[model samples]
Target: GSFWINAHIEAGKFLWQRSNKTLDSNTRLRTTGQPGDLDSPGDCLSLLVSEDDLEYYPGLPYNPHDCSDNQHYPLCERILQDTQQLLKDPLLVLEETISINIAKMENNVHLILDTIDKSISAH
Candidate 1:
């Protein structure tokens, strides 16, 4: 389950009245999942996202997928207490993740240039 997720209905309920928690029962709303039965393999929460979803529902965060599935990568939000203790630098995380893809793109560009150079040299 996610940070605010729970098995009970009360846990899913959002407190509209910020001041009072239990007393303000009238001002409350349940943040339930999409209209469906609990038929998934596990109850863990995940965002159901796909490439096609970009055109229709861009930046919409309502979809939930299997939490345990390795195919889906989770986006983490955390306040850093100590930057030195961090295993990976938060600033370079995006760059590191796409480094391999960037290298492949560079290699492809080099190969294309080499092919063009060979064609000119042969001529």
Candidate 2:
């Protein structure tokens, strides 16, 4: 009965997916506020070689088949996907743990209730 955890996680993932799609669109991408300066935001994705020498900025990789049919730079899309999956995993683990604990509670339900009732009566 993880009503709170389950509902909240699903809603968050849904909202993130929708917002990410909107950001990937051309209208937004075109006016994405790219600067004409040398220190463009694009520079952030440049390869970090050996933590010292700043070498090749080879450019975004080929988009994978599963990515948004196009436009998604392979690495960026992967990072997004991985990040989404990583976020989902913890919720799944929490759900599984909740389920397991609930199952265990079933076996001890009577004993647990009795103990609670006894403690309350003594108080």
Count of clashing residue pairs in every prediction: 2, 0
lDDT per residue as tens, model 1, 24-79: 21221212334333324333333334656534555543333443445544444322
Please give the lDDT score at residue 22 for candidate 1. Answer: 28
Model 1 scores a C-alpha lDDT of 0.41
In order, the Cα lDDT scores of the candidates are 0.41, 0.34
TM-score of each: 0.26, 0.31
What tens digits encode model 2's per-residue C-alpha lDDT throughout 1-114?
000101001211211232332122112122122323222221212112232222222222111122222322222222345677899999999999999999888869978999
Top TM-score prediction, candidate number: 2
Best by lDDT: 1
lDDT of 1 at 94: 68
Q: 77, model 2: CA deviation in Å? A: 14
